[model samples]
Target: MKKIILTLFTAIAVLALAACSSTSGASKDKEITLGATAGPYTDMVNKAIKPSLEKKGYKVKVVEFSDYIQPNLALSKGDLDANLFQHKVYMENFAKEKNLKLSEVVVVPTAPMGLYSNKFKSIEEIKEGSTLAIPNDPVNLARTLIMLKDAGLITIKEDTNQLTASEKDIKDNPKNLNFKPLEAAQLPRAVQSADVAAVPGNFALAAKMDLLDALQLENMPDTYRNRVVVNTKDLESAFAKDIKEVVESKEFEEVIDKEFKGFGKPEWMKK
Candidate 1:
């Protein structure tokens, strides 16, 4: 009888400890640290997402990264609960190359890349022999080149994978346009020198240029759209679910419409 009594007490203590452990994890999940690039993305989190999460009793902290690499590194190292600076292509590629487990929580409204020109008012106004500026990096170079194709400035080889296309893959160049590959950040300033500059949305906005002011904006794809990402291990966590719910909330869209005008939205947001 004494042995039975001792066993009962031990079981009760073990159950109590388990309850305490569960509560501690719940408490830890309530505090989330998210990383984003230092610009409109950071603003989006601060003004739109944070408030809704706060209402649900989550303490939100946003860390800004100037370059893209550090955010993912921090997230992989468990320094951040999630991050919001990269697209699907970048995230997947980075994860595979670095051997880190990461997943997207939700896709957000992303600013679209635009063709900006100081001289030309429209795509039709581009002249023969004009020196067009494009992104120097392969990924953006391909995307920017596609934007030019859509504008009727050039035609890419049908056999080519447009995702990795470059000037060498051009099947037709109606304008005899000279290609100048500049860094993405320098494209905004390239407008003053080059006939037209293909500037990514983030850099354009950071330079105080308006989105509607561009001659054309890319029909940004889901793969190219920015998303909220977290460690794959946390995919089933309550807080991760809450983050998705907060982003999907009507209030979040209201903030996006009011503050991030002219930005490209995901298809889910369209529906």
Candidate 2:
């Protein structure tokens, strides 16, 4: 009798432990967390992707970050299931520098960089000695210089490439324009203070600044050059597949076209 009682107790305890484990697993299986930048990215996720995903039986939680770095960091640390905030080159550079184990699951949208100004109507109007604000970050500063060169405002050193260029890279300063290197996020605000500012499209849109007045805008490819990044382990998740589908779908394509106002297009929808 004593042996039977002990066996029964052991069986009950094991069953209870299994039940708790099963419940925990089910809870985890029900939800997926995605991180994105605060502007168009988040708006698209909320307005289009989230509703589509939820209808398909996923509990989708979209997290928004203002800065460029946090979404990737969160995805790497397992705080987020995925992130949609950077381009291929930026992701590769960040992974190489940080030794992070992340992969692109799907491409969503592309936000091109544009040269904006409150004071000047066009590149032709930018006076000599006018102050031009550019992002101070290495990659973006190079990009801005390229745009300025494209505008025929100044020239970059013949040998310099897209990945490397500095104020020192300027070969000809015909405008004698003063180049002010500032944080990427701060460039929009500087438009009010500077004579001209080179701002990323997303930031400019977020600030409600019009790109029609931009002296120049980069002609980026129409599609998802930037992507949704995920942990290597979660790459095959069903929720991830659903998220990708929603982003790549025609419904989302319409959203991108209407919301971004030609600054970007859905990667999946672009030829």
Candidate 3:
């Protein structure tokens, strides 16, 4: 009876050890969830990032958001492991406002902003006093103004920092064009009603407006390129490192070239 009882206890101990070992393995392989907006950002992860990570035995989950605000919120709240939908300036401004500790993992390709007009086929055709729609947000409004300045439709004040310029900062409106500051998301629809609309690349892609159709486009500096961002704490983690590798890989460059044709320029090619 003593021998049989000792044998049963040993078997139970072995089973418990096995169960603990199995749980540990499962925890190590937990799927990582990344947040992004619905257009090219999501497409890049689903088409390129996912497969690349999966090949290395990691399962990646991509969560899509429509607006620009929520992905950062999600990442800050620990709902997402990382995100790839925002530019460096936008991310810095957002983190400062929200008091969130965040950092960039990599700078991916950029989707350059453009001036699109259905009413006028060319920038020269845009007449004086034409109501032009620009983004209401501070950073993007400034970006829009710079693009217009470059296109010679308007001139921004020489003293003002062009990156954050607002309608108040316009030094000259050559045609005396009317400026309508609307929500960035609404600019695509505004293109139909407004004589000229300045649209961000992502919003344009979401609205299916071809960049080639824009009368003028801005090939912005590297500071404006989209980034893969994570909570500052995770910047050195295995998952974050994998994400950086995947985004900077040749395969990802191909995705940018194929799916986003005229929209994104490869990071290496950035001036």
Q: Between 1 and 3, whose lDDT is larger?
A: 1
Model 1: per-residue Cα lDDT over 178-230, one tens digit each = 98989999999999999999999999999999999999998887888999999
Question: Model 1, residue 13: what's the lDDT?
Answer: 100
**Segments in model 2 whose C-alpha atoms lie over 4 Å from true places:** 1-30, 221-225, 266-269
Give per-residue CA lDDT, model 3, range 96-135, as digits (tens).
9999999999887767889998889899999989999999
Q: After superposition, how far is residue 223 of candidate 1 from its true place, in Å?
A: 1.1
Kindly report which residue stretches of model 1 are placed more than 4 angstroms away from their true locations once superposed: 1-28
Count of backbone clashes for each model? 0, 1, 0
Error of 1 at 144 (Å): 0.7
- Between prediction 1 and prediction 2, the one with superior lDDT is 1
Model 2 quality (TM-score): 0.77
Superposing all C-alpha atoms, what RMSD in Å does each candidate have to the true structure? 5.5, 6.6, 4.7
Give all candidates' CA lDDT scores: 0.92, 0.79, 0.86
TM-score on alpha carbons, each prediction: 0.87, 0.77, 0.82
